[model samples]
Target: MAIIKLSAIERRRLSAFITCLVVAILAWVFTALSNPYKFTVKQIISFKNAPQKRAFHPLQSDTVNTIVQGSGWQMLFSRMNDDKKVIEVDLHTLENRNYVVLSSQLKQINFKKQINNEIIAVNPDTLFFDFSSRRVKKVPVKLITLLKYQKQFAQSAPVSIKPAFVTISGPAEILSKIDSWETDSVVLNGLNESYNARVKLRPSTEGNLEVLPKSVMVNIPVDEFTEKTLEIPVKLINNHNYYDVKIFPQKVKVTFTTSLTKYPDTNEDVFEAVADLDKWKLGGYSVLPVKLTHIPSYSKIVKVEPRNIDFIVKK
Candidate 1:
């Protein structure tokens, strides 16, 4: 090989060229990263360290204009993942206005590690809440059920819930208004046997409230029913001594359907048929309808024979 060595000046010139190229590359990269960009991203705001007595509502502040700032590349990558990450907002540090200023704590937050880019602005800037100390109350749970059983079968017992009452915690005003909670409507058709179900409790109130146990176990007893008939004597009520009243066919037949188990114990004494004297008019054709009273709650009145009786009034 021919002996060839670059002069010191030539080496210096090559070094400078290399340094300039490196600087230009760095400047280009910096320019690309320094440009400001905006992206709309969803972020979960969690409340932490709240007062033990007061239960805060709305774990997330709100989905408002949440704009994050970063380079074009950072924003592009951030938008790729649709799922949002959560951030904590300390409730203990809330101000007198009960507003949690989210952006104020962003500097101290380890946001860089959590997200792909830095957040420029969290819209709504502040979260306002109507916080109230929770007061727990045990209220009865009513059932909302639609049952259509097979022919001759009906509900034998009252609608039963495992936890007849639920524990609810909310503002004093809301809690005071809630005397009971109700389960979601459960429709059961062609039901022949006893049934059990796990039903969710209906939203008791429209406001912010927390239920300890959201669901309840429901049990409904069902049984076959039998048809029964009873003959009840018709009686006149509030009669004046001035006129005497008499009704043709003094007795009426009351037919009902009752649970098979109760068919034996059911009797005529459970019902009464009466006609009001106030309806009586002298020398006028009066057809008074026989009204049955004291019917048992379990038995359903099918019909009353001799519903209207011909009555004669005398002075």
Candidate 2:
């Protein structure tokens, strides 16, 4: 390789020429970007004011390419952005026809946009839909929850959902299979107190299905749970002959967990322990198993003492 050394004066002249060239390139780019240009971008299509007499299912994907006329800077920035752009299409015309001309609604869609770019056209120009018999039905809302409770805390009562039922309108064939709709999962962690809030329902997976009153109010009762034990008398059931039966243990200790608020009200009266005498006569079993026949549904049984009792029958 050969090296060519230049004088100080020559080096300065070369540097000045390179700086001028860079400046010229930047100026040209700025001028070009200021000019008007047209470009295409894909946006999601959402419908509003759907026809009440008929249901519609779109034949194409929800995405549509929009041809936009704007400045070169707008086109450059729009292409660089990754956010989902949604265009709302009015379906009022569907009451008379099965297709919608996108060009006719460009003014409305553009008015909702924040940018100054003009939507020139929508690819496919027209949106086609299949009509079906419209059906309206009321279905129960099932709450989906992902809950974590603090130590020694639990749900004290049933979860309450205001307006337990929601009105749904969609195609008859599709709505027939849907008996219930679920809300978006309500996630709460380390909860120690009662919770009340409004949650959004899960969006419809199908394009034609619609749910009214998109959200519902939810209430969850929370409390600290404590253990309680009671001695419950054991009663014999299926004593057809009214046999004189004496059990080794007359009573069994029932240990359960209940909310602190109901601790005082929970007692032996709320529980019933019974031994089936039919075990000896029908099953020929020597011992009878003690079973809690009646107990509060909310109570969680911990342990039952004397699970099996020895019995003597007087012939």
Candidate 3:
């Protein structure tokens, strides 16, 4: 083996030659990418301008291969990009015909994009459909929520949604299976006050179904909760044999949490504590259990002073 060492001047010359070679390669690459080229990419197909008189379902796939004529740079960048392109087909022709030609409507579709990247062709040049009777129906809009509230705070009133009902139109058979449409999930954390906003509804999975007024307004009422204690008289029930029953404690302390807005107006009249005599007769229990038969909505029962009562029965 022979080791060849070069002088300082020779080393500098070699470095310059390598630098020039790299620059020349980069320039050629850039020029090639700048030239026009044609390529094909997969795109999702959507529809617009649906025929009002006809209900149709597509017989083909929702995706198609789109051939585009553009700069080589576009092809190189498009391959690296993760975003998908969508092509929309007009269905107005379906009123008189059963199929649509994608090539014929490229001009109309491209007009909406207002771009110079021309679409050369589509793999599935034609789209077919299955027809059915169209039906219109009105269904309730259900609000979906995933909410978290601050400590001692809760919903004080029923949640409200404007235009509770939405109109849906689609194939008669499909519409018959749907009773209600649900909105996108409403998510909130540490909710402590009233919330009001507009939410979009979940889109239909069926391509032939259409939902009107795609969004709805929502209102949720929230309030702070406070504790309340009331002395409610215990009533005896299920004493079918006319037994004279005397419970040691005639009244029990009911401690509960209610919204601040209803605190002032809330009273023991809204609560009913009863001792079921059937508990002893049916289960042969030694002690009678006291239960709250009636409690206001949106109120939480914290503690009942005497959950079990001692009674004397005489026949």
Candidate 4:
């Protein structure tokens, strides 16, 4: 490598040339920025104050093209700013007209006062909407949950929602079809104990439909269960007494699995075992199965031991 050194006078001249070039460019930009220019930008329109008991469908465009006229600096600053310019349009401030004319309704620009500019025009200048008259209706809230539990553990009681019902407001046609509101589906696995969670309700797909309070608390009662055994006496029914008959075993054992909370309350009074006397005859060498009667649907019956017993008859 070769080393080259510059004289002090030469270095000064080079520095001066570069400085002048920079200043000239700056002066040109200042003049250009001072001139008036026209530019287009997007303005957000937020709707407000809709009619009571009515819903407005979504608009095709969420924003409007606004043409602004101002100095280059002002227009450039306005476009460069990241803040969303909100143009609030009150729907209630309309006549019998079915459509909204933005240009006429929102003539003034609602931007920062620091930016001195004029909104020359708004593209499309008008917005068309379909309004539906809605009525309030109370509908039940249904819980949606897919749950799995550890072995020997299960849901002991019915799942409940905090708010039994919710208010839905929508078009009469849509509301008439809805009888209940359902929560979003939630899957939880390996749950060994009680489970509680707040789940969000599913949103309606209809653009004009609305649901209040969007979410509710779900209470799922769970408990551990144990096996229980009880003996139920067998009774003979529809007997004519013309022939004497006897069942070999007079009692039947009923086994079941139930939650611990209900285990102490379990009793044989709710179960019945019966064998019809009229269905048999003398010298009949056949077994009669005991029929279980009045069994509670909630308890899981494990087994009905000795379902049938040999019967002896004398004529």
> Which of candidates 2 and 3 reaches a greater lDDT?
2
Whole-model lDDT for model 1 versus the true structure? 0.76
Q: What is the C-alpha lDDT profile of model 3 across 53-102, one tens digit per residue?
A: 89998998889998888888888988998897888888889999999999
Model 1 segments beyond 4 Å from truth? 1-50, 55-97, 101-121, 132-139, 162-164, 176-179, 203-208, 242-245, 282-285, 312-315
Worst 10 residues of 3 by lDDT: 108-117
In candidate 3, the residue pairs with backbone N, CA or C atoms under 3 Å apart (3 or more residues apart, or in different chains) clash, namely none
RMSD (CA, Å), each prediction: 12.8, 2.7, 2.0, 7.9
Candidate 2, residues 34-78, lDDT tens digits: the string is 999989999999889988788999988899999999988999999
lDDT, candidate 4, 1-315, per-residue tens = 998788999999999999999999999999999999989878777666655655666556778888877899987788689999766666664335556776665443434333557776788777776666767899999887788898988888878788889998877877899999989997889888787888899987764577987999888888888889999899877667756777778888998888898888878888888987655644353787788877754567889889887777787
Off by over 4 Å in 3: 1-5, 113-116
**TM-score, per-candidate, Cα-based:** 0.64, 0.88, 0.93, 0.59
Per-candidate Cα lDDT values, in order, are 0.76, 0.92, 0.91, 0.78
In candidate 4, which residue pairs clash?
none
Number of backbone-clashing residue pairs for each candidate, in the order shown:
0, 0, 0, 0
Candidate 2 off by > 4 Å: 1-18, 114-116, 205-208, 281-284
